[model samples]
Target chain A: MNLVLLFPILIPFATAVACLLAWKQRHVQRVLSITGAVLLQASGFLLLVSVWQSGIRAVQMGNWPAPFGITLVSDLFSAIMIVMAGLTGVTVLVYSLADMDTGRESFGYHPLMHILLMGVCGAFITGDVFNLYVWFEVMLIASFVLLGLGGEKAQLEGTVKYVTLNLMSSALFLAAVGIMYGAVGTLNMADLARHMGTVKQPGLVTTLATLFLLAFGIKAAIFPLFFWLPASYPTPPAPIAAIFAGLLTKVGIYALIRVFTLLFVQDLEYTHALLLVLAGLTMISGILGALVQNELRRILSFVLVSHIGFMIMGLGIFTHLAITASVFYIVHDVIVKTGLFLVGGVVRAERGTYEMSSLGGLYSSNPWLSALFLLPALSVGGIPPLSGFWGKLVLVKAGMETGQYLIVATALIVALLSLLVMMKMWADAFWRDSPGSAAGGSVVSANPVSFESRLVLFCPIGVLGLLTLAAGIFAEPVLTVCSRAADQLLNTEEYIRAVLGGIP
Target chain B: MEVVMSFVIGGLYASGLYLMMRRNILKLVLGIALLSHAANLLIFTMGRLTRGHPPLIPPGEVRVLESIADPLPEALILTAIVIGFGVQAFAIVLIRRCFETLGTDDLDEMRSTDRAP
Candidate 1:
């Protein structure tokens, strides 16, 4: 009943309402939105400290006990997810303010931004399955509006496919929930875990499990179901694109981990094997797509898909160590990927396009920006002393311990290819001279030395990049937390007892 | 009666999948709507068939009557239908917008923009 647990959701929701009421005054809306983001970050930090000191916290809405009432629970994993969501929300807000056009901002972008954050945070913290579905819809609806906010030809066309695919996925998600509830007689995740233990319908369970996987798979942009992502993601403005690239897919992964670990562990032999095969294919195919792409953003989108395999690989291995590594990787990938996309935005801004062939020579003109971009890029490539390296190391170790030889090999090879693709981007964008260097073509340099503009974009990135270093350097403590989270997930009785007051 | 309901459900699913595979934008919307209906019905059927009993309990009874229909799945189906309707409405609007911008309802025409040209 600690009120702090509610702020991460409430602050943004309240701010969104406030922004909508004051929508005519763009400056006031901006102030409210930015202040809301900062407040969310502060509250998230406080919640994290509380969760670390205490055990998991469960808040049953309306005080109707769990298994009966809707609940919002925050375990260590969820707390970490909330904090990451807040950090990303703030970073994207700052970037959007600095980068978006005034006309676009006036079209309720600020309010929508706050609402989107509210949905994301709520999804991360909610304890009930049906509530998770509702949050997914809330988040998707906002994203649908945001994706088409620009109303360009490409944006409109891409939004069609994006909306269609996601809508189907959403329908499937509801169907899955229906089936689960019908089978287990409860929508509460904790209750379902208990009741599911007594169910004898293996065939029906597998079907429902597969349905859930497909629904989440599409959202996460896994290999077979990922076509919609690269198509729609590149069409949005950079801030929108960056946040989507970083945060949205991870929601699918989060749901996957939560459902698979908590509800479907009895059938892991089947599901984990399926996940392993999917991970291998996802890694190889995603990188191959990246390798062939010429456009900067498109290539990054494919690479983003490829990196998802690494996280899923950690889950497939299903060890304490492996799950921990997956958690660490998820946090690292979100920050690094978002930073890279923001850097991509900067690149596009300066060059007037996202095509690598049409742009170059940024390193000399803006060394600081280049450095900021380079750190995350290298980190994502799994260079030492960066966050990416530690995550990969843990996954590889877990893979070998599980004797999953092929998965281990695939992970290493994918890591190499990721580095190659990133290096190619670096060479093409920063190292080479501009295409019209001899002609001295008019390049739209948006104040190359503007400290305030650069600070607005780079500070969030700097904080994330520092986190990358810290995660790598201080892997032990983070791993310990992940282990506890994993243990809690695998041990169903603890969750049930905590929620249902000593279990039914 | 159960066999007939299952056939109806299967027919809906088949038609939905067929429409979804089509290139026409309007058909895609129809496909989603049909598929959602089929799924909701399938979930409803999973509760098993009950006969000769209403969903409500008698006023004096402390527990539900025997052979009563499972009301939980019906409640779930109702919620899902409302959600599906909202999503479908939003999709229809988006499709209309797409048609306005691209000047074609054909998926083939939309492909050139999403893929590398």
Candidate 2:
């Protein structure tokens, strides 16, 4: 009877429908979008608080009993994720006020954004695997429209690769779900988790696990399956790109963690070992790719891929501490990466380009912007008293405690390399003069941002930066929550009982 | 009958994969459509074919009186088919837009974003 779980999802969906209805009226759409975003954030907070007090909450849609109907379950992990997602939705929607043009808005940008949020929240809170696939499609369709809305040549090109690859992943995902249903005759994740142990054919289950890995791996942008990310992420507007950077691939990682930990743990050694190898390669390839990129967003995109490696590394280690670290890192990364991408938006606004070579002297020109950028930049590089540093410290410690010295060393090296990439971006975009500017070419914008314009853009980045700092300084409470979340995820019996009500 | 359905599904999958790997955008869309059908068929076959019994229980009955076809797979396939239709329609429109905007259907040439100065 805990109807609070439905609000975070339904509010956004209702907002999206309202936005579409008011599509001809820009102000009305904006009001609905903002109101929806605020409501979503509010309900998300409520969900998290309730879940924090109560162990886990489950709601059967239409009052249908579990295993026979759609179930929405919220544990600490999902509740926290939904709250973080709500935060991203609110901040990015606000930022979009500055970043998105009326052309895009008139073309249904607000509705699509709300729909995207709905899909993201739905994925986080869903208790069924097939429901997750449906949510994935919801997200995919919205993202496709968002990416290609501008219809710029670059956007179209990027959308093609992005759409094609993502659709293929969807097909793979659907195929896997079909096979899984055929095998177990159940779609509820908790029930499947309970049934997997007695499924009689462990090998088929293992094969299905690998199939899911490949499917979610592509979504999460793991190595060898991540080419579509760098090719597409940089093509959209700043707000769109920032939200994508913040949430889309992470949704894939979330799916990976859920399925691997819940339904596929019977063959942990095999799957996790495979995860460890991919993590090392994802870290290495991503940083190396970033080292060579010159565009700020492109470089950030590569680093984004690399950071996914660290999260996966924790999952690979698979201890209570490691899972806790991964959860913390996910929260930290979502905030910092979104902040970094907003900084990218600022850079794009200040100098009409993402090319670091074409940009320079931002530090001197706008020290406030530089300060905003530096916090997340340095934090992402694992500087102490910054959020990324704490996540990295816990992950590396988890690695060491597990006697994974090579991965520990690789994690350390990746941290250093990440710092190097961040500094390179700083040196090129903020400190050094733009190469074109140095040559007296047209590097700076002709029309400088107005005070009002600056306020619109600066608020989101400043809030995100402050949050990052706060998370770092007040790391203890967040860690306790994360550790408890990890414990709940590992304790599947609790989840199954919560969902099924002892029916089994 | 099971073997025949299996071959049909396998053939559809092979053709779908071949078409997806093509350089043309239109073929890619067709490939996706083919794959969706294959997936639906696979689900149907996996649910096990039954002669003509619907999974309906008689009115006012607490349970089904006799063995019947599994209704779950049909429900799943129906949903998948609808979703697949939407995705395929979107894909076609996207390719058309890409072609109109970028003036190319060859996947190899859709590299405007990937290019360097």
Q: What DockQ does every candidate get?
A: 0.53, 0.70
- lDDT of each residue in A226-292, candidate 1, tens digit only: 9888888888899999889988889999999888888877778888888888989999999999998
Comparing to the true complex, what docking class would candidate 1 get?
Answer: medium
Cα-lDDT of candidate 2: 0.91
Error of 2 at A356 (Å): 1.2
lDDT of 2 by residue, A381-419 (tens): 999898899999999999999899999999999999999
Which residue runs of candidate 2 sit more than 4 Å off their true CA positions?
A440-443, B57-63
Position A486, candidate 2: lDDT: 96
Error of 2 at B113 (Å): 2.0
RMSD of each: 2.2, 1.4
Model 2 residue pairs with clashes: none
TM-score of each: 0.95, 0.98
Stretches of model 1 off by over 4 angstroms after superposition: A439-451, B47-71
Candidate 1 structure, TM-score to reference: 0.95
